[model samples]
Target: MNDLVLTGDRPTGPLHLGHYFGSLANRVRLQERFPMYVLIADYQVITDRDVPGEIRRHTTELLLDYLAVGIDPAKVTIFQHSAIPELNQLLLPFLSLVSVAELRRNPTVKDEIAHSSQSAVSGLMFTYPVHQAADILFCKGTLVPVGRDQLPHVEVTRLVARRFNERYGEVFPLPEALLGEQPLLRGLDGGKMSKSRGNAIPLSATEDETAALIRRAVTDPDRVITYDEERRPGVAGLLTLAGLCLGRSPGELAEEIGDGGAATLKRVTTEAVNEFLRPIRKRRAELGAGDVRRILAEGNARARERAVRTLEEVRVAMGF
Candidate 1:
């Protein structure tokens, strides 16, 4: 079996700054060294959402963001989730291998449930991790790049892969979690940065939009800037963002903006963000729906070929 990578995002919204340093940048570099399959997880959106509208539009935007971020279509097989039926089919046998109690044991799921503070989480949401394993193993992914919070899901995938191979034969390779180097980028308000919170800076945002968003970033009244995250998270968050954009350290950046106060910190952050995103913005603007559709068409076809072969092998191994 060919070793590959499987990584993607739910098409709930456009890609954001947190996504950039968290996983996107790493994926751009990984594609060059490995056969990477980027999935636009449109199907995963409905797992927690009440009404998953605008998914097609969001999926197209996601493709555009992938291209804009230098994830070359030629090297990365970027495919949408629903387009490949065989992938989800793997969930049948995969889910049967795990129990409900085991799924609840996944820490990510528990955290999400507590975060949402809702008792109405659907069955789909509960079984989401098992579905993720289908996404990974269908591509024969040996490496899954994820943040610390996502490690449990990958662990679940590893468990399912191991169990399947032990019972049905050695048909799948256990995928490893390639943890991200960057710490979690917090919201401008020093809280969670999510679409629902309206605190994240999307990659598709215009230069003016970026500046406006940064202008409102929460920062303290301290005149002398210093990188003390525990005491001053708001200021440090902006510093962290600017540092990532300019490839500098947050402490060094804090020194540069010394005594400039929150205004100067936000200004520097705005400039750094705009300057870094200029090229990516240009690329995102140049891309169109036509470009997105054609890329997905070809990618989905290629992905189908891969999924079909994997499924056939799985059937033969299981005497189906």
Candidate 2:
């Protein structure tokens, strides 16, 4: 059988261009060739439970975002984390396999703990990677597409697989990381593209709104408008967005503009982004919120079947 491929996004906000390039586009292809699962990790969202209502809205919105971007339910499973309790059940033994030092060393968890407002980080937060490992392994996923920052999670998953097999029986495969080619697309302010940062162009944003966001995107202060990732990261970022949207190389775009001011760069970037978003906006409207739920409902049933089987095996191994 083809290797299982699994990946997903948090339900904090709408999917963005970075998501498209980083993994979703690849997922669209992988589903045709392999067993694929796209998870909307709502349970993971509780790492910061400050805004329960926002999470509720985005859980449904996340379904729309995936469908709008061409993730077909027929091609791959797309389920929310909350719907799969079996995966959560596996988290207990998996967490026992790793030490606190190992969990504390997880860079993603560390960054989250440092930035979050919570006075004390929960075990869920510290051992989040193990939960993530459960998410993948429960589906028997053998290949996980993730960003550079998430390679560490894949590593932890591999360790979990090894420990499980050594202690119990050989059941899970060691999943490999499928890293993408795109540069890490920073937000408008040049920080990570995140909803809370208020820097992302929401997939649901209108053409005018998207353009306006691009206009305010930061550019290099040194050269004013040159596209040099190393020296002019800001301008290079704009070029990256335009290049990804227009299907042109960033260098080609820079050469074509030839000393264009930041305004010119922003204008072109805005136009390219607006054009790209137009179709998605229409698709999003057509799919509607109700349709999104229907698709995810179907996906959840499919995902649950596979997850239930895996958990049964896990329970038998643990003598449950």
RMSD list, candidates in order: 1.5, 2.1
**lDDT for residue 231 in candidate 1, whole number 0-100:** 96
Query: Could you tell me which residue pairs clash in candidate 2?
Result: none
Count of backbone collisions in candidate 1: 0
Provide the lDDT at 124 for model 1.
85
- lDDT by residue for model 2 over 1-320, one digit each (tens)? 35989988888777777777777777777777887898889888867555445877888887887878888888888898898889888899999899999998889888888887566777678878999999999988888987788899999999999999999998899999987775687788877676677888888888878877887888754434556777677788888888888999988888887766788888989988889888888988987667877888888898899989999999888788
Model 1: CA > 4 A from native: 117-119
The ten-residue window of minimal lDDT in model 2 covers 220-229
Q: Give the TM-score of candidate 1.
A: 0.96
What tens digits encode model 1's per-residue C-alpha lDDT throughout 94-135? 998999999988999888776652348888878899999999
Clash count list over all predictions: 0, 0
Top-TM-score structure, candidate number: 1
TM-score of each: 0.96, 0.92
Question: Where does the lowest 10-residue lDDT sum fall in candidate 1?
Answer: 111-120
